[model samples]
Target chain A: MTVLDIQNLTVQFGGLKAVNGLNLQVQQGELRCLLGPNGAGKSTTLDLICGKTRATSGRILFDGADITNLAEYRRARHGIGRKFQVPSVFKELTVIENIEIARSRRPGLLAALTTFRTPLRGRVKEVLDRVALTDHIDSKAGNLSHGQTQWLEIAMLLAQDSKLILMDEPTAGMTIQETLKTAEIFNSLRGEHTIIVVEHDMQFVRQVAQRVTVMNQGSVLAEGTIAEIEADARVKAVYLGH
Target chain B: MNRTNHYDFLGYVAFAIIILLGVPFLLGFDGFELNTFARYLALAMVAMALALSWGTAGLLNLGQAATFGIGSYVMAMHLKLAASTGNPGGMPDFMGWTNVEALPWFWQPFQSLSVTLLAGLLLPAAVAGLMAIFMFRGRITGVFVAIITLAFMVALQLVFIEEQRFTGGQNGLTGLAPLELPGWTVDTYSLPFYYLVAGCLIVALLVGMLVVRSKVGLVLRAIREDAARLRYLGYDVAAYETFVFCLSAAIAGWAGMLYTLVLEFASPTYMSVSFSLAIVIWCAVGGRESLVWASVGAILVNLAEGRLSDMFVEGWLLILGLLFIFFVIFLPRGLYGLAVAAMDRLRRSPRTEPPVPVKEG
Candidate 1:
């Protein structure tokens, strides 16, 4: 039940190897947290898996399919969804319209032209309810608060029905209460969806991560349960600033 | 539909009434006045067309006049052929003057009115589709698209002017015969021709409105906002961009054809950079966000230009330039945004309370 398998993944930017010889595997319905200091190539690895960055040499097998050379949209079609550091949503469109786009079965131009707006009743309502954004469904996405905008992006991923969700710093720039709520939402999604989160806040990571993978200088330094990684001397010296 | 869309639909209806009924009633049947208005209406279609890509898809196509000129030349070629049926060698006067013995192979198909009409629409779309595929597939966006499109327009204009024998060069295709239908002829300076232009404008506007209200339009707006975000959401951003670009190009071409009919000629001037830029200005002044408002902007600007030029003569161009600057500085969203703000104020004045949230289970 491996949902994602990366083997010897490497991406070099000119003289720098941003992500080199990275290998990782995630099981279905597993909530894995990726931990690293700045410039540890955590984001680069995610980009490679999601087809945003082409690997210099490696294979990314998602759901048993080798998708190393697939386009970004093709990777997304294969159920890979990514949430960036900044909240990204259509600012001018209503919340309902944004969800409708993500929930669209056929995102082609011809299909979109013929698809009616009124028929998006069930799944749209369900995802909105899950994100607790049902009340603000008619408001413009730009008008949403920062925390709300982040939740709306999560709601969009839910509406997209993505099998594997890749989130980078989901709790960044949030108050304590909002972070706790986001942690709660992640916990709720753990058993039904496979998620890989790259987070800086250790407390947020402890709340949601079933297992931790620590990366440094372009490769995985260690992988273990949270308690095990905290006691590792190498992790302490490189990442925890001991 | 939501409240905003409902308001938008009402706006379209009011616009239709103004163009179809109000203007005709005001102008009466004076051929000169009607012809001028008809030309303005046709030009409005190009403005709306530009708004589709520039406003919705975030593609600023500065070479829109290339497609427009293609459409004009196609229609003019047909009319030129139709008018030369009795001339020596049965070819256009320009061709005969240029010492061409027979009609060129490319111009032969234009002899058939059906072919000419279809070509007028399809040629522009196809050309635009090709350019869009090239640019969008390469992930080119924003100002780069504008520069490339502007360059192509200048190149196309040069081709038309330099190829004197084929495209009628600087003089363009003139002395076009009246369009002949089953039992009637379309005289350019007549009521029927004016109605023809108006009817075409209405249909074009309806088509533009339909595009803006569909899910495709929703995605396009998203593309405009953040194309990279849409791409990561399992949508081919380039495909959507290309679709809208081609649609806009086809509409611009249609406008060009109507313009040729209104003015009785197709010239290299139609493909000039200034003409394409003027279309963009009209769209910007009308509020590029709303198609109807963009058309209104074109008509209003043209009307002002016509009147002011007559009154001030030497200084009218300066006045127009200053007015454009004022609109760009004060009303960045154009008149539509202004109207929307005004309406929002009026709606909130009486209620004084925030709207109640409709809870759903």
Candidate 2:
């Protein structure tokens, strides 16, 4: 089933058209990769979906609901989690505390306030384990390494319990081995939730994302399997570099 | 082990509480008016509330005094009216001069102690709630929030001063009676009043402590640290801000009602910008994150003023300004922040150095 439906979406800022007439859809629990070079509206796509940026004209349907105008928190409660390009975990909070905030944010206010209503602690542990961050659960998030911060951000998204997560460049500053371990974590979470990831790394895109969308100049250049998109003439002409 | 980073600090607070409680009995009586101490405790109520909202939540509300003043004046107006009808206390002179044959309709309900108590909390809370809705929902934050509220405080104070016939002008209402608790009339100005203030301080602290220790406190901290990330995480940053703003003001208002009983009058000075700034300084000196420290900061700073005024009266404020700078630079976390840091270092150093079971106790 289609988990996200973007139709005739456009975003304009003053005189600049950041996004124009983009149409796309993702399947349930699907890992869709959006690839583009610099200034290709890759970040803008996530912004529009997450309701952080305004849409000049568009219809964004999330799980059969029209969330075009829904604010981030309302959209979050309906299961849309977001991660920025830079690591955005709670720095002053511990690794576990950061997850606790995420876990609390995704639920209803009363549910979030009352601990006995749900086993938030165990669920937090589960997410920490998935990201291989269980050992540093009590450590402050600010003290983490660059690669570890990325994993902590992922762990935070998992704690929110949102079915669809929007991640911006999950492995931007990671070493090759760290990227492989991140891929393992992403692969492990495949069937349980949908993830719309934006990354410029071609190899990482090919490693995990089943289907890929290539955007260029505020529009889609190609949308198909990773191999098909990597081979497209238009993709190579605009994004892959001549 | 969690190492009790939270409780290690509480140990000092527990010691302080014991001293505060035992002081009255230990000294026997030092000509200290019980009524004034009660009043101090009531003011502490406002201090505790200020700590939670501004210190922990990172909201700079320059109009907290405005909220407290509103509650105080409203409660005072009611008390003044009650004295007019067969009460032994002299009716407020302003009422007699205004040549008012009867009390205004709104002031009628405040005559009842139960009703006055209810209005004391609700009226200011309602006003604060409405103001917070307009500000927070509009995404107004930081200096804007502080400035707009400061403007409101100044404007409200002006309104109270100018509408002299109603609020008794700048002179304020005096000759007011005290709150009559169950089986006891609180007229005497002894430790009974001090105990009353102490009781209020305890309740307000308990409530503030509950708020700061909850999951709500975590969200508040997160909002202060980075609100944009909070929005992306699917949390309503504005709503949380509004909730804390209103909650803080409500507590401040509660404190003000008790404060009126202590001072026996409410005036425009209650809502002055200087008062708001003083609260901020108190929180800064005590510790912003720890509510208990904020209270300690408020009381200790005021106590310092008393001693300094007796000795170097003229240079006290100058010394205070220097103290403020020192706390901001060297003690950025304030007193509580410093204590928290020291505890963390103490907890961490054990494993780093030799690791011989780490005699934590």
Candidate 3:
């Protein structure tokens, strides 16, 4: 089934079309990579999907339901999660506390007050182990290294039980080993959750992308398997700068 | 609760014991001293209210005194009516003195103590809710919230002062009668009355601590650190902000009601900008990060103000101003930071060597 279907998605910032007349679709549990150079509107597409930015003309459907104008948090509750290029985690809270909040069954004022006895310790432990951050569970999130912070954000998304995850350059500042570790994590999540990754690292994409969508100048230039995309003359000329 | 919260609980217990039993019995506090301490406790309640909204939730509400004053006036109105119930004329003395022949229609509802208490708590919360709907719903926060609240408070002060016939004008609500309970009438100046004030403070502290250590606190701190991120986490940022804002206002209102009983009056000055600022100062001085310290800071600051003003008369303002500046400059974390650091040092002193030994060549 189609998890995310974007129709004629157009975003205009005063005559400069960041994402113009774009159309894309992702199947459930499919790992798709969005590839482009600078100014390709890849990030803007993610923003539009997550309701962070309003489109000039578009419709977004998640799991066959129209979510075009849903508020960001509502979309999040509907199982849409995004990881920015920069890691954003609650810096002051401990790692377990951070995951516990996201893992809460009912995250609201009254539940928070009365249900203090159940701390989500078991769920937090499982997420911490998944991210290989079991030792840092009690440490403040701010004390973690850059790579660890990124992993913790991924753990947060996992704890959120997001059905679809949008990642923007998840390995932007990682060491090669850290990048490979992240690729392994994403590879492991392929069939369980739908994933759309926008990345500049071709090597990382080669490792995990089942299908690649190449965008340029605010529109999809090519969409195919990795081999088919690499052989496309238009993609090579527009994105590869051939 | 974890280790830190466990320690905080112990600290609260110690504070409760000290105030309830130690001060009057061991410290030998007389009626006057206890009454003064009771007044300080009331102010501390206001400071803790600020700590919840400003320190925890990252909202700097500069108009807190508006809510506090509202609570005070609501209770004072009830007390005035209670005192005047048996008189030949049903009207309070202020209504007669101001030459008002009849009780205003609005003052009729406060005749019931339960209604008065509910209004005393809910009125400020309702006002805060309206303000929150306007400010937070529109995503107004930080300095703008501060400015709007301060302006709101100043406006309320003017309205209270201008409406002379109803609000008692500049003289304010004075000559209030003793609050009558079911069987025992509360003597405002007595030891039991002081204990009642202390008990309120203890309850407020316990509730505040529970909130600060709960998942609510975690989310509030997250909102403080990064509200936008919290929004993306499927949490309604505005709702949480509004909830904390109204909750804080309710607490301030509750404190204001007790403050009226302690002082035996309510004045327009209670809602003034300076009074609101003083509450903020107390929170900052004690430690906005910790509720216990914030309340202690309020009491300590007020105690210092009383003693210092008595000694320095003319120079007290100058001295306090210098100390505030010093605290702002050198101790940005406030007194709570100092306590945390000292505790950390004490804990580390015993662990002189690493648990795992290194093998030397």
Candidate 4:
């Protein structure tokens, strides 16, 4: 059951092919890792999949539906959630309020106006508990520590019930302990949610990635299990300065 | 739900009591003073409206006066028509002076009080809705929104000034007949009219509070914090922005109508860029984050302006400018934020309690 299928996807930014003829497929419930150096087009590919950056030419089939031209919000509504490399939670709102917004079924103006906030309390609590942020539910997101902010963003994804989650550098600025905890959280989400993580940290990648996809200039250099990817001659050349 | 929010609620109740009861009775103000206060209250609505979009929805509408002017003109047109009932072809005096033979079709509907009332609010809302759709849909934000709105306001004021036969040009619609209700003819300086303005302010505050407390308000604040993030979270950021913009404009228009009643005319000056910026300054001074304080900012600023101008005469404008700069730099959150900080300090000084330990069980 392929949750995401990118076929010959290419995004050319003024003659520079940021993503050129990229093809990748992730099975439902698979925790896939995208490993690449800077400017390897890992982020660009995620942007294309989430409808943030329109592809120059390609077909993105998500859950077997062609969604290459959908709007970003519409794609999000269809269960494609993205966690930015930088924590981007609403800073002024409480953690609970942020989760409440993510969990909203109808995100329209009238629906928000008429709907009561009390009904989503149970679900919000559960999502917060999953991220180990239940104690800081009432704290403003701006007040959260860096690791806590990242976890809060993950909690938002959980509250959104996103079927396919795309995370970029999920453990970028975290202690080793926090990184391990995040990896454990990712492992716990396996089989219930399909996640694609773009990571630079090999240790974090080794802890969570079931399959590793190494990207070079603009396309996949290699794809296999962690053990196999580490042994690939081409991947070595790309990472070790060819 | 939090201590700060609890205190804010109580503060609003106290403010409401001051406006509804204290001003009218305990202040011992005469009819003239009361009418002046009524005018201040009317202007306060527009300030609060600006706070809703600028502070909550992250839309800096620098052309709020455009909507406010539309509201004032709509009410004034009806009053003009009412006053021209016995004139030739039932044409307003400005039209008569400009050599127009008959009333314009646009001015005809304003003959009915109910139609005029509805148009006062709905007209600004419709105009704002159109502008909001154009701007928000294009993903225009930040200072760009302010610039576009400011340009539109300048254009509107010019239109009012150029179209003399229709909008009375620079003079605007004047010598309006007092509003006639079912059995009573309301006088602007009378107690009933003052109460009418006060009552409208009260209603607007209540409605604003309801919105601030709702999930919509929460989402609006979220939009303000990061609209792109909200978009990726599956919300139509444009729709929410447009909703708040139109709503804020409608409230500004309502205030404009009340303003016409208090001042006895609708002038093109009401749509000026300076007037629009003054509304923003009022919101900033009162604290844009708090609705009650934003309104209070308008009243306080106007009251100070009245007194300072009388006392300083030549230097009042400079003093006001200095005051605004001081608030912008020293107290970014305005008086409301300062008061909240003071309250926090007061609470802390009484007891040096240890921080509560996080419960693991």
lDDT, candidate 2, at B20: 63
Tens digits of lDDT, candidate 1, B252-293:
999999999899999999999878878888888999988889
C-alpha RMSD over true interface residues, each candidate: 3.7, 6.6, 5.9, 3.0
Give stretches of model 4 more than 4 Å off: A116-120, B27-29, B353-361
**Model 1, which residues run further than 4 Å from truth?**
A118-120, A240-242, B354-361
Once superposed on the true structure, which residue ranges of model 2 sit more than 4 Å away at CA?
Answer: A116-121, A240-242, B1-5, B8-16, B30-33, B86-92, B99-101, B341-361
TM-scores of the models, in the order given: 0.96, 0.93, 0.96, 0.96
Model 1, A33-88: lDDT tens digits are 99989999998888888888999998899999999999999888888899998888
TM-score of chain B of each: 0.96, 0.88, 0.94, 0.96
What do the candidate models score in CA lDDT, each in turn? Answer: 0.89, 0.77, 0.86, 0.88
What DockQ does each prediction reach against the true complex? 0.54, 0.46, 0.51, 0.54
| Residue-wise C-alpha lDDT for candidate 3, range B1-361, written one tens digit per residue | 2666777788789889988998778536678788888899999998998999999988999999999999999999999888887754678887787788788889999988889889988999999999999998798978999999999999989999999889987778987888877787998768888889899889988888888877788788888888877777788888888888888888899999999998999999999887898888888888888788888889888989998998899997787778778778887668988887887678878889652222210
lDDT for position B54 in model 3: 91
